[model samples]
Target: MNVPELFEEGWYWTSTQYSPNLAWSQSFDDGLQGNLVKDYEGRVRVVRRFPLN
Candidate 1:
C-alpha cells in the first residue's frame, strides 16, 4: 500500500483550523488525523473545487 509514486508518506495539512495557530493534518504513512501548529510546514496536494451551473 506504500505507493511513493502516488503520494509521499508524510503529514499533509488540511483546511480545517482548530485555532488561530493550529490546523488539521493527516498522516499518509498511517492514515491518522490530527492537528498541528500553523507555523509548522508540511506536505499538501492541490485541490480545486468547481460549482455546478
Candidate 2:
C-alpha cells in the first residue's frame, strides 16, 4: 500500500451544494468543513479510483 503525498493544504469543494448561492467545502489544513458562498476562493482537487478487472 502507498500513501499519496500532500503539499500545502487548502479548502476543497464538495458535491453537497447549499442553496443556489452557497456550496460545501473541506479544509485539509485542520479538517475544517463548512458551507461557503460560491464566490469564495478555494482549490479544487479531483480524483478517481479504478477497480481491478
Candidate 3:
C-alpha cells in the first residue's frame, strides 16, 4: 500500500485460511523487528518496520 508523503503510517487488509490436514501451519516474514502497535481504541495503528528492501 502507498501512503501520502505527509503521513508516517499506512494500512491494508488481508485474508487467509489453513487446512486441518496440513502437518505445519503457514508462516512468513515481513522483515520487521517490532510487534503490532495499537491505538487507545484497541484498533491496530501501525505494523512496525515492515522492511521491503
- Top candidate (lDDT): 1
Residue range 1-53, candidate 1, lDDT tens digits: 33456778899998889999999999888989999999888988765676766
- Candidate 3 per-residue lDDT over residues 1-53, each given as its tens digit: 56445333333221222233222111122322222223212112344557687
Q: Residue 22 in candidate 1 has what lDDT?
A: 97
Q: How many Å off is the CA of 15 in candidate 2?
A: 2.4
Q: Could you tell me the TM-score of candidate 2? A: 0.69
lDDT of 2: 0.79
Model 2: per-residue Cα lDDT at residue 52 = 66
Off by over 4 Å in 3: 4-13, 21-53
Best by TM-score: 1
Whichever of 2 and 3 has more lDDT, that candidate is 2
TM-score of each: 0.72, 0.69, 0.15
Candidate 2 residue lDDT tens string, 1-53: 23335625888888789889999988887878999999988877765667766
lDDT of model number 3: 0.29
Q: Determine which window of 10 residues in candidate 2 has minimal summed lDDT.
A: 1-10
lDDT rank order: 1, 2, 3
RMSD in angstroms, candidate 2?
A: 3.0
Quantify all predictions' global Cα lDDT against the true fold: 0.85, 0.79, 0.29
